[model samples]
Target chain A: MSKSAILRSSIAKKYWMALTGLFLCTFLIGHLIGNLQLIFIHGEEGRRAFNEYAYFMQHNIFIKVLSYVTYISILFHAIDGLMLAVQNKKARPQKYAYNNAGANSSTASRQMALLGSIVLIFIVTHMVNFWAKMHFEHIPLHTYEVTLPQQTNPEMVYYTHNHSLIPIQVDKVVVVRDETNLYLENTDLKLGEGYKDLHSVVMAFFGQSKNGFVTNSLALWATILYVISMAVMAFHLWHGFASAFQSLGLRHKRYTPIIAVTGKLFAIVVPFLFAIIPVLIFIGYVK
Target chain B: MASKTININLKIWRQKNANSKGSMETYKLDNVSTDSSFLEMLDQLNEQLVNERKEPIAFDHDCREGICGSCSLFINGEAHGPDRAVTTCQLHMRKFKDGETIYVEPWRAKAFPVIKDLVVDRSSFDRIQQAGGFVSVNTSGNTIDANAIPIGKAAADKAFEAATCIGCGACVASCVNASAMLFVSAKVSQLALLPQGKVEAQQRVLNMVKQMDEEGFGNCTNTGACAVECPKEISLENIARMNREYLKAMVSAE
Candidate 1:
C-alpha cells in the first residue's frame, strides 16, 4: 500500500490514537511529578523549589520543544477520536431497534468518547487556569521572607548592582525578606521581579484562610471540579492504557496480563495522587 | 428431552430490496415446538404465509447449522437473539415464553445493505478476504513435506483459534461503529502466525487492511462487542495480533 493509503486507513488512524495516547500518558507522569513538589515541599523552601522548577521548564529549550509536541499530540488525539466517532456513527446510520451493547463491552470502553471529552475540557480549563496565566497574562510576583547572614560593620562591600548576592560578615545573622531574582536579570528585589509564582497561585487557588473559610468559593468549586476531572482522567486511562498496546499490536499472551495490570495500576495511582493535591490544600494540610 | 409447544408474536423486518423502503411485518405463530430452532420457527411462519397466498417472508439460511455464517438476525436488541454465544440458527424457541413478543431485524450497517427481509449482502467481507486472505504456494508437483515443519503447540493453537472465524457479519452488526476490524483481524492473524504464511504476511496485512478501509467500515475503538456477539467465540486477541502484524508490515515497508 502507498504511504498515504496506510495513513488514511482505519488501522492507521488507530495507530495514531495509540501513539498519541501513550505519549499523553508520559506527559501525565512528568506533570504529576512536577505537581508533587507542591505537596511534598513546604514553606519558603518548597515555594522556591517549585518556582525555580517552573521557571526552568518555561525557559528550557528542550522543555519548550516537548511542550509543543505535547500540544500537537493532544490536538491530534482529540481530532482523530472525534473523526473516528463521527465515521462510526455514519457506518451505522440506521440505529438498532434494540441494543444491549453493555452486555458485551465495558462501560468505560463504550463511553471512551465521553470520558475523553471530559478530560479534554479539564485540560483546557487547566491550561487556561495555570499555563495561560503563567505565559500570557501579567501575574503578580510572590514575596517571602528569609533569614540571611549580614555584615555588622563591614570594611568593604563588594556586590552586584541588583545585590542578589550580597557579601556579608560571618558573625551576624539577620532576618530579612529574601527577594532575590533567581530567573531573570536586572530585577529589583523590593519590587518583586521575575516570572509569576505559579506555586503560590496553586496554593492560593486551593488554600483556605486561617478561619477555616475558603478564600474563594470559585476556587473551592474549581478544586471540586479538578478532583472530578481527575476521576474522569482515571477512567479514561483505565481503558486507554491497555487499549493503546492493543492498538499498537503489542499483544502477547504471557505479557499482556502483566501490561494490563500495570496499566490499571498507573491509571488509578496517577489520578489519585493528582486529585489529592487539591484536597490536601483545601483542608489546610499542605498550606 | 421432552418438549412443549408455544404461540408467540414476532415483529420481523421486511424490505423488498436495497433501494426499497423497509418496515416491520407482524405475524402470530402458534404451536412452535420448544425444541425447534429459531430459524425453524421462522420457517413455520413462512409456511403459514405461503398457504395464505401471500409472499413468504424472505430470509437467508443454507446449512441451517451455525457454521455456514449465512444466517444473521438482530433479535430483541442483540445480534443472534438474547442467547449468548449462539447464532440465530442455534437459538431455540424454548428461550422465549409463550406470549412473548420478539423483535427480529436485519443487521443495520451501511456496508451490509439489506437484500430482502433478513438477508444482507455480506460481499464486503468476501472482498476483504479476497484482497489477501491466502498465501501463495507453488502448487506445481513440488509439494513440501507437511511434517517437516515443526510448529510450536501454542502458535498452532492460537492460529487454529483465529481460523475458526466463519466470516459472519455479527462483528460488524454488533459493533456500534459497524467496524469490520474483528473480521479482518481474524483473517490476518490466522495467516500471520504460521511459518508457511509469514513469507507474504507483510503484503497480506497491508492489502487486507486497505481493502477493509475501502469497504467504508468504521474504525475500531475496541468496544469489544464484536468478539462477544461472535457465534464462533472468536477472541479479541486476534484483532490485537493483526494490529501487531500491520505495524510490523508498515515499518518493514518503510
Candidate 2:
C-alpha cells in the first residue's frame, strides 16, 4: 500500500487511535502513582516526599523525554478522534426517522467522543492550574528552620558547607535556620523547602479557609470540577481501555474476558483514587 | 390455523429514482391478516394499487426465507421491522397492533442511494466482496481431501458463526454512523479463522478493508447496532477478530 493509503485510511486511523490511547493509559498509571503520594504520605514528610518526586520528574532527563512523548500522544489521540467523528457524521448524510442506538451498544461506547471532549477540557484546565504555574510562573518558595548536634572540628564544618552534605556533619550535626533547600533542610523539624512547594499549592487549592473567602470558594469549586472530571474520565476509560486492545487486534476468546475485567477494574480504581484525593483534602482527611 | 385480520395505516417513502426527491405517502389498508408477513402486507397493498390502476411501490426481496439477504427495509425506525432477530419477510403482522401507524423507508446511507421507493443500490457491498472475499484454491484433478486439515472445534464454531452473515446491509442501516464494520468483519473473520483461507489472509484483510473504506462507509466505534439488527445474529466479536487480523497483516505486509 502507498504511504497515503496507510496513513489516511480508516483502518490506519484506528491503529493510531489504539496506539496513542494505550500510551495515554500508561501515562495515567505513572501519574496516578506519583499523585497518590500526596494522600499516602502524612504531614511534612509527605509534603517533602511529594515535592522531591515532583522536582525529580520535572528535572529528570529520561522523564522529560517521556513527558514530550505524552504530550504528542494526547494531541494525536484528540485530533484523530475529532477527524473520525466528523467523517462518521458525514457517512450518514440522512438521519434516521427514529434511532434507538442504546438498545444495541453501551452508553459509554456510544458517548466516547463526548466523554473524550470533556476529558480534553479537564486536561487543559488541570494543566493551567498546576503545570503552567510550575513551568512558567515564578511561585513562592517555602522556608523553615532546623537544628543539628554539636560538631568536632573546623575542617569538618568547612567540609559540610563545601560538600553541601544533607546531614551537615555526621558526628556534630549543624542546624540550618530558614533553609529553602530540601536536601539541606532538617527532616526532623518538618521544614518546608523553597522548590515551588506544589504540595502546599495542592493543599491550599483543596483545603478550606487558609486563603480568604474568594479563594475558599474557588478551591471548593475547583474540587467539585476535579471530581466531576474524574467521573468523565471513568466513562471514557470504560470503553477506551478495552477498545484500545481490540483496535490493536489483541482479541482472544480465552483471554479477552480477563482483559475486559482487568480494564474495567483499572478504569474504576484509578479514577476513583484520583477523585478521592481532592475530596479527602477538602474534608481535612489528608491534612 | 385461521387468524383474524385488522386494518393498518402506513406512511411509506416514495421516490421515483436516485435523483428524485422523496416523501412519505400515507395509505390505509383493510383486512391485513395477523398471520401475514410484513412484506406480504405490502404485497396486498401493491395488489390494491394495481387494481386501482396506480403505480405500485417498488421494494427489493429475494428468497423470502431471509437467507438471500436481498430484503432491505426500515420499518417503524428499525431495520427489518421492530421484531428482533428476523428480517422484514419473517416479521409477522401479529407484532403490530391493529390500526397502528407503520413507517417504512429505505436503508439510509451515503453509499446506498435509493434506486426506487424502498429499493436501494447495494452494489457497494458487492464491490467490497469483490475486493477479496474469496480464497485462491486449485481446481486441478489432484484434489486434497475436504477434511484433510484439522481445525479445533472452537475455531470451527466461530468461523461458522462469522460465515452466517448474509450481506443484507441491515448492519449499515441500523448503525447511526452507517458503518459496515460488522459485514466486513464477518467476512474477514470467517476466512482468517479457517486454515484453507489463512494462506492469503494478510492480502485479503488489507484489500477488503481498503475497499470498505473506499466505499465511503463510516468507521466503527463499536456502537454494536449492526450485530443487534442483523438477521443472522452476527456477533460483534467478529469485528474484534477482524481488527486483530488487519493489524497483524499490516505489520507483516511488504
Candidate 3:
C-alpha cells in the first residue's frame, strides 16, 4: 500500500487498460457518426456534405490533436492487455486438457488477444490503403495536367488493389482516354484535386458516385471489421467494464448490479450501432 | 428403486508416489450400481482392487455427503459431472450409460500437486485462507443477537453463497487461467460483509490476495467459467467484490 508500490502492481496495469479502452470506445462513436454520413447523403451533395465534415474534423485543432491521442490509446490498450495476459499466464503455469467450462465465454472473449491481433492486422492494412494515401502519400491536387498512364485505368487498378484510393474527378464526372489519346469515355471517376489533403481525400473517397461497387465493397469489409472488432471489444468490455469498477473501488452492493447491467448494456448497444453504418452504406440501403 | 449394478472402465492416473512416474492405468469394475453416487462407485472399485491385492486408486475424500468438497476428480471432460450443479460425490452413476469408459483424473493445478492418483494436495487453498481470512473474534460462551448486524436479506443470502465454498480447488481446476479468485474472494467477502470482522477487513483482503499470489494461483480474468463449473455456483460477483475490497485496503494503507 505504499505510494510507490501502489503505482506499480497489477492494479496499475488494470487502470491503464481501462483508461485506454474507454478512450478507444469514444473514438468508435465519433468514427461511426462520421461514417454514417455515407448513408444519409449520396452523389455530389453527399460527397460535398461528407467532404465538409471530413474537412472540419481534420482542420479542427482539437480533433487533429485527438487523432494523435487515439493512436496512443490503441498502442497503450494493446500493450497493457498483453502485459496483463502474460502476467496472468505466468501466475499459473499449468493447464487442463479438457475444459467443459468454456461454454460460458465466447470464443472472442477467450481469445481476446488473438481477435485483437487479427483486428490489428486489418487496421494496419486499412491505414496503409486509405490513411497512407490521404495523409502520407503526396497525391497531386490537379489530375487534368497529369498524363494518363499506359496501363488499365489507374482508378480501376487502384480500386482492385485497395479501396482507399478515391478516383479523382471534377464535378463527379471526367473524361477517359486510351493510350492513343482517343476519345474513350468511362464514368469511373479518376483521381482529382480534392485528394491532395487528408480531409478532401476522405470526402472524395466516400462521396464519389462512380465505382459504386468497389466503394460499397470496401465499406462492407470495413463494416465487417468494425463489427467484428467491436464484438471483440464488447466481449472485452463485458469482463472489463465491471472489473474496472471493482478495481476503482466501487463496491456498494446496490450499485454493483446496476453497474454490471449498465456495463453490459453499454457494451452491446454501442458496438451494435457502430456496426450498422457500414452495412447500411454497403448494401446501398443508405445514401 | 433398488440399486442396479453395471460394469465400467476407469482410466485412472497411477503414481508410485509424487516422487515417482505417473501414468494412466485402466481398471475394470463389475456390478457398479446406477443409483450409487460417484464416490460410492469409486469405493466399490477400490474394494475390488484391494481384494485383488492391488494398490487401490489413490483419491481424496472425507465427508461422503459432498459438504467437505475434498472429493475432487475430473469425470469425463467435466470437473464434477454433466449435471449443472453438483459435486463429484453428489454425481450419480445414472448420468453415465453402462459399459462406458470414464476418464477419472485429479484436479490439475500447479498449486494442487497430486498427493497420489486422484487425490491432490489442495492445501495451498488452506494456506491462502490462513494468511488472514477468518474473523478475529474468538468463540466465547457469549451469544450475540444475529439481528444486531442489520444485514439485508439479499446481502445475507450472498454472504451465505460465498460462505458455501468448502475450500474446494474446483475453481482453480476448472479455470482456464487456474484462478483462485472465487475461492479467495469468497473467504474475503464473507468476513467483510459482517460487522464482527470489520476491524480487520483491510488486513484480511491484503494478506489473503498476497498469499493467493504466492501460492501460484492465476489472476481472475473474470471469464465466469469458474462460477458455471462451481459445485456451489459461487458468483463472479464475489471476485469483483474482493477487487473492490482489496483496492480499498490498498488505498487506505497508503
Q: Could you tell me the lDDT of residue A220 within candidate 3?
A: 46
Off by over 4 Å in 1: A42-45, A145-195, A207-217, B140-150
The complex in candidate 3 yields a DockQ of: 0.28
Could you give me the TM-score of model 1 versus the true structure? 0.88
Candidate 2 lDDT by residue in tens digits, A1-287: 56776577787788899899989999999999999998999887887788778888999999999999999999999998988988888888877666656666788987888899999999998999889988887655543434333564433433234346443344343334343444433445322345567787788888643312223457778899999999999989988888887777677779889989988998899999999999998989987
Candidate 3 chain B weakest ten by summed lDDT:
B216-225
Model 2: residue B49 alpha-carbon error in angstroms:
3.9
Q: How many backbone clashes are present in model 3? A: 5
- Cα deviation at A195, candidate 2, in Å, is 1.9
Candidate 2 lDDT over B73-191, as tens digits, reads: 99888899888899999999999999999999999999898999999999999998889999887889887885999999998999999998989899999887788999999999898
Per-residue lDDT tens digits for candidate 1, residues A14-78, read 89999999999999999999999988998767878888799889989999999999999999999
Q: Write the per-residue lDDT of candidate 3 for residues A26-120, one digit (tens) a residue.
A: 78779878866766666556655665576577678999999999988888777767766676676555444345655555454466666566656
Q: Tens-digit lDDT track for model 1 on B105-159? A: 9988988989988899999999998999998878799988766899999988988
| Alpha carbon lDDT at A211, candidate 3 | 25
By TM-score, the best candidate is 1
**Model 2: what TM-score for its first chain?**
0.85
